[model samples]
Target: MSPPPAVWVSGLRKAYASHLALAGVDLAIPEGEFFGLLGPNGAGKSTLINILAGMVHRSSGRAEIFGFDVERDFRRSRQMLGVVPQELAYDPFFTVREFLRLQSGYFGLRHNDDWIDELMAELDLADKADANLRSLSGGMKRRVLIAQALVHRPPVVVLDEPTAGVDVELRQGLWRFMRRYNQEGHTVILTTHYLEEAEELCSRIGILQRGRLIALDAKDHLLARFTWRVLTVTFDKDPGPLPETLAGFLSGAGENTLVLRLDQSRHSLGAVLTALQDLPAQILDLHVQEPDLEDAFTDILGNMGLEQP
Candidate 1:
């Protein structure tokens, strides 16, 4: 038999006084999958996450966590989930170790120094365990948030821009740790504006726009939907002239190079090379860049052009 789904939502809806935040959203996240929730600002990414965290009341819909209804089994739902919120909200008076201890206590977990020590060491917070929250850097504080969330070892973990304001080294460390948890059978749901991270880490992705679920599928499938490719042709010297046919495909001409955005289905790379023939300069190099998650994100939201809420 298949393992239970970590999360399930059907016909989910949420509304404010004059606006709807989510409209008939439906999604199911299988256990142990790294899922990405991607969208521009005000695209209902946070709203969906809020509903899952039970921080927001839904107008209509059903949400289940580990087969427990969120509305009816609030305690169980909350117990099975850990959320690292986007914002930094922590008590400055507590030390890093103290904070995790307190958070675990809220879940009725007794003090477990071994677990706390392991978490601190794994998150690189061992040296800072005795330091006050106010004494740590922003990235360190973010680690504290993650440590607090994992104190009870919830089956599902939600990270909302956990890398925001974090340094590159810390970001890499965080991703590696998240991957370890995912491999160990913990479901991870990530929401971020960083598309590159999503492309690199998530196996599946969901794109939201204007409170609507625009796209949801495996990462490769989502990228396959965007077939536009970019070719860069570099010249030893500045090309003094251009072909008339090349003008249509040329996106821009930079210093000693020309960039073309071509639909790969209709025009092949050979065709692009043929169009660049007879230029007044020798070819320095050729580079091809494929569409990434950021490209898909722009294409989707640019198509919607929704007004702000």
Candidate 2:
């Protein structure tokens, strides 16, 4: 039998005065799955995260973490979950080490030095363990936030834009650590506008648009929904005009490059190459871009509320 879901949200609805923040969103995240929540600003990603963290009460519906209802068993449910919110909230006076100890204290843990040191090392913050929170750089502070969330060793971890404003190397390192954690039975749920991160890290993804769950499925299945491919052809010089054969296929045009949206069923790459062979200018470069999570998100926003075939 399949293991029970670590996090289950059903018919989750939330509203603020007249505006709906979440509309009947339902999600089932299996144990050890790396889940992603992708959405643009104002798409209610924060609201959903808050609801799951027990920070914001839902207007209606239910959310459960490890069989503990969020509403009825708020403390227990929260104890099993760790949330690193988008905003960095910390006490400036405390050192990173003390901060983590305080967080561990809240969970009623004593002498968690082994786990705390392990977390510090994994996040590359062991050197700054005794440094005050105010003395650390933004990147270092973010690492502290991550360590604090994991102080209790929660089963489920929710990261809301954790890599924002961080360097590429750190971002890669974070993902690597997350992958190792998930492999070790931790259920990780991430919300990021960085489509590339979602594409690389998540096994399953959900797209939210205008306060609704627009799409949800495995990464491959969701990517398959974006059926169009884009080709960019840059000319050595302005071609002056596109060829007649290429005109109908062109979706956009830049100063020296033309963008074509090709449907595999109707046209092949060979045909496109053939049409551009006789162009006036030399082909400076050719790039074929496949549809990714961002393309799927754009499609979802455009086709929201419609049944996609």
Candidate 3:
């Protein structure tokens, strides 16, 4: 039989008292695929990741890593999966190298010094290898967390907001390192609030709303699904209130500029210009911005009764 998907979950559910954290969520990510999981603060993104990491017990359903069931085959599944959590949690007593070594030892990797050195070196943590975890800065702690997760060279890696609060340079470096490992045949599952980062790195995107999978498709398909465009018009003079026909489409307004949100299937650009003819003000400039991942994301969230941020 062919090897199972790198990561698979079926009918996953997690309940805490009356509130349901994850409601029958099913996901399958193939090996070497760069997958993105996106959701708002309480969208169960963290709950799902915790379940897969074996940190939280699932209320119902199956979760597997490389075909190994997470619960029954916990050892194998956990060993093959590495997670860089959002929390900057670590043992204050241990140094960077010592912490990584302890993490490696958890998987019966008694002699992982060579790989440990490589991880620290690649992550630019060699200089701080002997520094106590508590003494390191937040950025350095994040790097050490990544190193610990990767110490055993797992085939599947889950990055839960790995770049949260980090500087742009560090964030860029993190992506480069992740991309390099992903190209080396490692499956990468990224969960972040940053839609743009997900848009650039992930081939497949899955969005979760209040305990539900709201959208799942390739990045391009998701973008193409929403047929909308934003048009910004600059008037040479102060154009008072716009015509009724164009007023409804107005999404933004400035001193002498107006931005219109147009559903291409329903509103035509010609209609916008025709309505604007009623104004005596001359058109200084006009620009049309195409819909991107953010637009699609907002549309999805808005339709589900939640305001998109």
Candidate 4:
């Protein structure tokens, strides 16, 4: 038989006073998949993560990790998952090495020094291993938090805004390590506002909006469904005024430039160029911008009648 999904949710719901944080959401992430969970602020992404991490109780329905029910088999489920939370919380007195060792002990692990050391090195925290948490920079502390979550070697890893407040160097380092880790068959669930990062890493993506799972599909499929290409035209001199037919497709404008949204099914680059020929603008340069994950995300949210960021 096929192995159970690395993570599963069914009819999950969470309520706070009169507000519903999660409204009957369902998701299934296969083992070894790199999945991205994206949503706007006040969406249920964090609430759902908190529920799976056993930090918050769900109002109804179920969550499971590797077929272990989150509520009934809490211990086993928790043991199989490692979560790097968005908040920066740590004991100021503890050194980086001490923190990870303590975290491993919390999961009933003993003699975990080797794994702890490896994690520190992987995260570029080896040089700061003996440094106290209070003395570390924000980015360094974030790396330590990631190490702490992985010290126990859980099969499933959840990273909630892991690269937030981190510098480009650290962010790149973390991505490299995570990519390698995920390629080794460990499941990774990431939630990030960096749509580009999600586009590069995640195989599948789930979009949450106002407590509902609005869209879920392979990354490419999602982009194909709602994203459109953009054609940017630059003129050598003033284009006078755009012709009526060509002006209809104008999505944006810059000094001597016009941006047009193109749907593959309805319009082609050849057609756009042909229409531009009749205009007074002498095309100095033309560029085609392919659709990306950010466009897909905005399109999805807009379709759902939510305010797009």
Candidate number achieving the greatest lDDT relative to the actual structure = 3
Report the backbone clash tally of model 3.
0
Model 3 scores a TM of: 0.89
Q: If both were scored by TM-score, which would come out higher, candidate 1 or candidate 2?
A: 1
Candidate scoring better on TM-score of 1 and 4: 4
Please estimate how well model 1 matches the true structure, expressed as its whole-model Cα lDDT.
Answer: 0.89
Residue 177, candidate 2: Cα error in Å is 1.7
The CA lDDT at 114 in model 1 is 89
> For model 2, how does the per-residue alpha-carbon lDDT over 217-266 read when each residue is reduced to its tens digit?
99999887666789999998887776777788889999898899888667
Listed in order, each prediction's TM-score against the native is 0.92, 0.90, 0.89, 0.94
Candidate order by TM-score, decreasing, is 4, 1, 2, 3
How much lDDT does each candidate structure score?
0.89, 0.88, 0.92, 0.91
> Which residue runs does candidate 4 get wrong by more than 4 Å?
241-245, 275-281
How much is the lDDT of residue 205 in candidate 3?
A: 96
lDDT of 4 at 60: 97
- Candidate 3, residues 1-309, lDDT tens digits: the string is 888999999999999997999999999999999999998889999998888889999999999999898889999999999999999999998999899988989989999999999999999999999999999999999999899889889999999999999999999999999999999999999999888899989999999988899899999999988778889999998888888888889899998998999999999899788788678898889899997788888889988889664
Estimate the TM-score for candidate 2. 0.90
lDDT of 4 by residue, 173-251 (tens): 9999999999999999999999998998999999999999999999989987854688999998767677776777889
Model 3 weakest lDDT span, ten residues long: 300-309
